[model samples]
Target: MIRVLIVEDEPLIAEAHRTYVQRVTGFVPVGIAHSGRAAMRAVADAAAYGTPIDLVLMDLGLPDTSGLEVAAALTGVTPSPDVIAITSARDVAMVRTAVAHGVVLYLLKPFTFAAFRDKLDHYREFRASLPSNNDTTVSQHEIDRALSALRTTDLRASTPKGVAPQTLDEISRAVRAAPEGVTAADTATNVGVSRITAWRYLEKLAEDGLVTRRSDYGRAGRPKTRYLWKTKHAN
Candidate 1:
């Protein structure tokens, strides 16, 4: 499993991020740190326990110091964790600095669960493509695919002729809000669209790798194909 440490000053936002991390498959929240100092301490404590943290969701603004400085400090750690900036800071210069400091992903604030999950999913794919054993040299094709996984593919560009982006967003929101997951009929009712229209949006999301479709066998007759948000890490 991928152990994650959340470094955010805001308590509520940190809690929300913790929840988001739990929803993904292959990842688990190791601990939360409200400041840079606390983050370093948490990292040490995790290492002491023998399970070092694998990833860090770092907010650029911290009460003690800037997240960039924290990232620099982590460079000297014995088992350093990969950092992903999760902050509202959109300054290009700050982003460039973060990239220089070894941040793998930069996620903007006020994002939906779908967007958040997409980032982590991409990260997972990138990590999965790495050499399972260090001795094996990475082939050029493997290297290219791993790097490509980190880049977000624009799902909007692939939208079919008739589906409106607004409708798709609405359908995505409805499904994401449903923790137990939602079917096309449920999405249709929530978004006030026809079942077929809702299914079209759900299918689009699934095709874009933002959602999952499964067979619901609970009901007696004709097992309905249920469309659910794919927020969890896949096995």
Candidate 2:
């Protein structure tokens, strides 16, 4: 099994990642670190314990230090684990920098479970394509085949029907702006859509693992559903 380490600052998000990692076959979540220092320590401890991490799901924004810095530091580790950047940052420069620091894959924020699984599956295929023995040398064609396994198709194709990307963006922004949480009615008012329409988008977000659903029981009548943006960072 592939030992994995998750480096995310947010407790809820980190837990979600851990759960996702557990669901995938042949992958085990060995540790979770909320900061760069903690991540480095975890890697070191795991290595010392004779179960080194094989993959790292790194979040770019950390409370202590930038994830890129941690990724760079990890390069010095013997039998370095492959890093896959998971972040909300979309800046081209950041992407280039992450690649330079040896990030094998880049997964943007607000992704669905399907997308997340696809990434892990691709990484597994990439590893399978590689030479199993350390002393084995691979040819150019073999190298190309291994790397090709990591390539992902366009994500837009996977989006559910009837969900407009623009409207989804607007709804997501409204939810993120509300620190406490937002109901479908509130989202409808903020995004200039009907309550049902807002609810549909909110449900989609929840299904995608971008936002969380909660029940508001303080009200007099039946409990109302509230949607809380999962990540601290805005996508």
Candidate 3:
């Protein structure tokens, strides 16, 4: 689960945001902070307990310092979590300021679920593809592809890897054979390959809007990510 800290001053808005986060498949609403100062305390407490907050859903107009100021403060600390500014502030200057402070995505308020889900799915893909190597270097093509993936909002338009399209068919066959929802590990077993290879194919399906991923809750050491065929995509 992506542990999230929501910073919103209004009780109703905070609750609404919390509910939305809970409704998502992979997000977990760890706590709510009604003010910038309260946000700091909650994050500090979580960090002290070793359950580091993975992300912050910040609202710019906070009771304390501006949300940008709160983000700036938290980001200067060790192991800063990713910040995505979720606020009604739409002025270009404020958006620029949020981006200047390293906010990944600045979401304007009053969006429908479809628009919100699309942005979130892009973020999920981007996070999943983050570099694991110590070297910060990458090829131009890799950078271009990664950035393009983030800007893409249409699920019908996502491109899969350069591998043969037959891989998709093979995946469908393998998953269809199983009565239960399949994990990448399961696909890897069926295809005689490593789990990481399996994950790439499954993620491609997710990108193509053929599959939906959900956290496998209950009876597990770690939350295993599972993929279920979206009903509309099944043949």
Top candidate when judged by lDDT against the true structure:
2
The TM-scores, one per candidate, come to 0.71, 0.67, 0.61
Question: For residues 139-199, could you state the per-residue lDDT of candidate 3 as single tens digits?
Answer: 7866765565466334333444464445555675465446476899999888876898788
Using TM-score as the measure, the top candidate is 1
TM-score of the candidate numbered 1?
0.71
Residue-level error in angstroms, candidate 1, position 221:
21
| Candidate 1 Cα misplacement greater than 4 A, ranges | 134-136, 154-195, 202-235
- Which lDDT tens digits does candidate 2 get at residues 156-226? 55468888866776787688669899999999999999999999999988876778999999958999999
**Decoy 2 TM-score against native:** 0.67
Q: Return whichever of 1 and 3 wins on lDDT.
A: 1
lDDT of each: 0.84, 0.87, 0.75
Return the TM-score for candidate 3, rounded to 2 decimals.
0.61
Q: After best superposition, candidate 2 residue 4: deviation in angstroms?
A: 0.5
Give the per-residue lDDT digits (tens) of candidate 1, residues 112-132. 776787788778878888875
